[model samples]
Target: MNESIHVVCTHCHAMNRVPELRVGDAPSCGRCQQPLFQGQPVALDSAHFDKHLKGDLPLVVDFWAPWCGPCKSMAPQFAAAAQQLEPQIRLAKVDTEAEQALGARFGIRSIPTMVLFRGGQELARKSGALATRDIVAWARSVIK
Candidate 1:
């Protein structure tokens, strides 16, 4: 089995090597040395969104905006889900406010929408906020 998995840095856009067997282990960016899970979602934009989605990894993208109450409410839940699902899934966030083109391309009609992608293909997507348990279960169901 592979001991490590590759993850692109959400901040600096650098690739990282994290131990696949140690999902609970806190990993830092080898280039930026920042905590991979810092209690805040990793912000994404069109600049690197396609690369992340198309990578050989499972990714969860939250389409959110600062003004959306439901989106704000779901932020922590998404973060918790990421901590639990690490080493298996990559967590990402796209600010619909900032990335209008991306939001339009994804046809995001509502805030707090969640999309799961694997190998560049969208696996599942849903609108509204979900609990951590539900998010994990949903992701597990779609994971190959």
Candidate 2:
């Protein structure tokens, strides 16, 4: 029997069971018919964030704000990290300016904080802006 993994749809927030072997085969969400891994970070609001946190796949979230210089500088690096981490990890972004409640909930006292979650539980967190290589390395080290 083939093992399966659960991935949350970035477009619809629906849970999908993808066979582990086919994870890199360009899987699509069953409900939304959207590509599951888009090689870019998904912009998530509070509601969608909660749903994605409960998924089986690890979620790496960049908590940032438009007004924050460091956050703005790290945006492209985060996007590049997403490209390198997709299919195995789901990368997401939360705008602290737009989702004040989420920032309060997560106790985000600073911008450019990256939080890693698995099965709705926080596994690790890092504060400050990181380059693409550092982001990828840190995420992989923590998840492993």
CA-lDDT, candidates in order? 0.82, 0.93
Show pairs that collide, candidate 1.
none
Per-model root-mean-square deviation over C-alphas = 2.5, 0.8
Q: Tell me how far the alpha carbon of residue 54 in candidate 2 is from the true structure, in angstroms, after superposition.
A: 1.3
36-141 per-residue lDDT for model 1 (tens digits): 6544456889999986765556888999999999998888999999877765687889999999999999899998899998878888998899999998888888
Q: Which runs of model 2 end up more than 4 angstroms from their true locations?
A: none
lDDT of 2: 0.93
TM per model?
0.81, 0.97
lDDT per residue as tens, model 2, 1-144: 999998889998898999999999999999989999999999999888888987878999999999999999999999999999998999999999999999999999988999999889889999999999999999999989
Best by lDDT: 2
Error of 1 at 139 (Å): 0.8
Each model's backbone clash number: 0, 0
